[model samples]
Target: MDIRQYLDSTYLKTAQQAGLSDAENVEVVKAAVAEAIEENFKLIMIRPDMVAIAKQMINDAKSHVLVGTVIDFPEGKSPLEEKLAEAEKAIAEGADDLDFVIDYTAFKAGNIAEVKQQVVACTRLGRKHGKIVKWIIETAALDDHEIVQLSALIKNCVITHLCEDDYNHVFVKSSTGFYKTENGKPNGATVAAIKLMLENSFPLPVKASGGVRSYEEAVEMIQLGVKRIGTSSAKAIAAGEAASGGY
Candidate 1:
């Protein structure tokens, strides 16, 4: 497949977490988004704290950029109502899209009903507000069966809601930067989950995140059928930096 064409359709996220709060972190993120947008990127995702600043940047830019933010972010341990409220607030604040993490604990504990309920609640709010929702499955922590089961549930939800199959409504994503393997290599299980979603006909996109810090890795994921690439190192990779280098 043509990589550039796929890149044109993919959403690139400039993620900021509790770390990287240095004086230059925000500036770097802004510059990355600006550069990515200039390079023809269609979507940019930022943290809730940086949403206002990101909004200002997007407003001042000459190009059109879709802004997104994470709700209940890297962890989905937050209460269901709280997550929904956060999604509502993000949409109200000019966030065109919202990416929410699935409750890993709930899923691991076999509380599949609760996990599905949370995803449904958040997606419902997103739809009501005319905003797009990307359900982050956090694939790093799930086994093959769990991944398949969640994919099926998401597909069922999308069909029940009558949403488009390519609606960007739900995404199976990798790690949240918390866990890693013994060798420190970023796990690629999420890629497998994404393939599962595609094979199962889930009505959503797939986003690969966590240790994706290079253009080659980004392209690899894209070649594997991911439609979105989430990273804080977009600028570095676009500039041809190696994945091992700091963002």
Candidate 2:
């Protein structure tokens, strides 16, 4: 199934988060960019600060790989204005896609209007700049019911105001690959959760992210109608080997 085009080769760890020096972080982003180009992966998702370097590297190599950045990433509790500003900066720096962390906490707290508004505002910004907007619902932090509910909410919000052309650009991504959960608990995209999201978010595509680390898992995800697979293990997966380190 040509899973390479469905993969978003991702490396979103910051220097501080990875416990590496700043220079090393830059090198990491550069390496991921190079791998994406060589492997013919779908997109390169990096931190916003490193978007320019990734863009330059992909451009210098004359590759058409799309560059993407995360907005209010990992945590989705940021104020709407702050996320908007972050999106603007990423777009200005050549990010073709923006993975936004939506405030599902607010939604679970009965703040549906606030959550919907945030989605509306962020999608508008992406549409205005002609960039794809993917909302990370952090499914690991929610139960099956919550996942289904949130997927429906995002679908409804995008359809109500966003143009038809932009509908395909907007997606319901499963995780940030960074959310924390209880000990011995799964903290990223899982097949059952992804299936639930796919079953619920009609027309709006789904991206299965996080713990997917092999060719088999990726193919399984593709079979479930997942439009994209987000993983740091994209290189190893494509090579038909297991990725040792977790994302």
Candidate 3:
């Protein structure tokens, strides 16, 4: 299969987490953008701050590779205004796709309305701007039942508030690859978790992120009906080598 088209070659790291200066972090993002261009990957997912430089580089290269960024990030506790402001800034910086982390904590607390509101607001912002928006539900933080329920919740919001044809403009993504799990549990995308998402969020598409390394794993996700795989190991997978979990 032409897996590059299904890959969102990604590198979303904070300056501190990566243990690098801000400038150094940009360098890493730049290198990833260069690699995406070389590999002809579908999109390059990076931090919002890197959007401008990545946009410039992608434009200069005259490449069709999309520039995407995270919103509300690993934590989805940001107020609506803050998330909207962050998303606007990224779009203005030339982002083509936005991955939004929904308020799962609220959902778990039985605040169904609040969770739906978050999805509606974020999806509306991205759709209005003609940008793709994927909701990161952070599967690691939830059990299977929560995954199905939330996935269905997101799909319902997308279908109800947005036109049915706008499904491709949005997605129900699996994880952030950053949520810590107790007892060393799987923190990213898993086959079972993804299967639950796919079953509930059909027609909305799905982006599998976190813990996916190597060609076999990536292919498995793709074959299971995911439209995208977010990984820092894109190059290794494409080279037919095992990923070192660089994501």
For all predicted structures, in order, the TM-scores are 0.81, 0.98, 0.98
- The digit string of per-residue lDDT tens for model 1 on 1-247 reads 4333233222233434434545667776677567656765556776766666666787887657677787886668998989988877777678877878788778889887898788777787887777767776766677777777776777676667645643565665554555555666545435566677666544567766666677787777887777777665565556656556331
> Best-fitting candidate, measured by lDDT?
3
For candidate 3, lDDT tens digit of each residue in 1-247?
8899989999988889999998888888899999999999999999888899999999999999999999999889888888999999999999999999998999899999988888999889999999999999999999889999999999999989999778987899999998988998998999999999999998899999988899999999999999999999998888878976667
For model 2, what is the C-alpha lDDT against the true structure? 0.91
Q: What is the C-alpha RMSD of each candidate to the true structure, in Å?
A: 3.7, 0.9, 0.8
Q: Enumerate residue pairs that collide in model 3.
A: none
Cα TM-score of candidate 3: 0.98
- RMSD of candidate 2 to the truth, in angstroms, is 0.9
lDDT of 2 at 92: 92
Candidate order by TM-score, decreasing, is 3, 2, 1
lDDT of 3: 0.92
Distance from true position, residue 138, model 1, in Å? Answer: 1.4
Prediction 1 TM-score vs. true: 0.81
After superposition, the stretches of candidate 1 with alpha carbons farther than 4 Å from their true spots are 1-24, 165-168, 180-191, 236-241, 245-247
Q: What is the C-alpha lDDT of each candidate?
A: 0.66, 0.91, 0.92
Q: How many residue pairs clash in each candidate?
A: 0, 0, 0
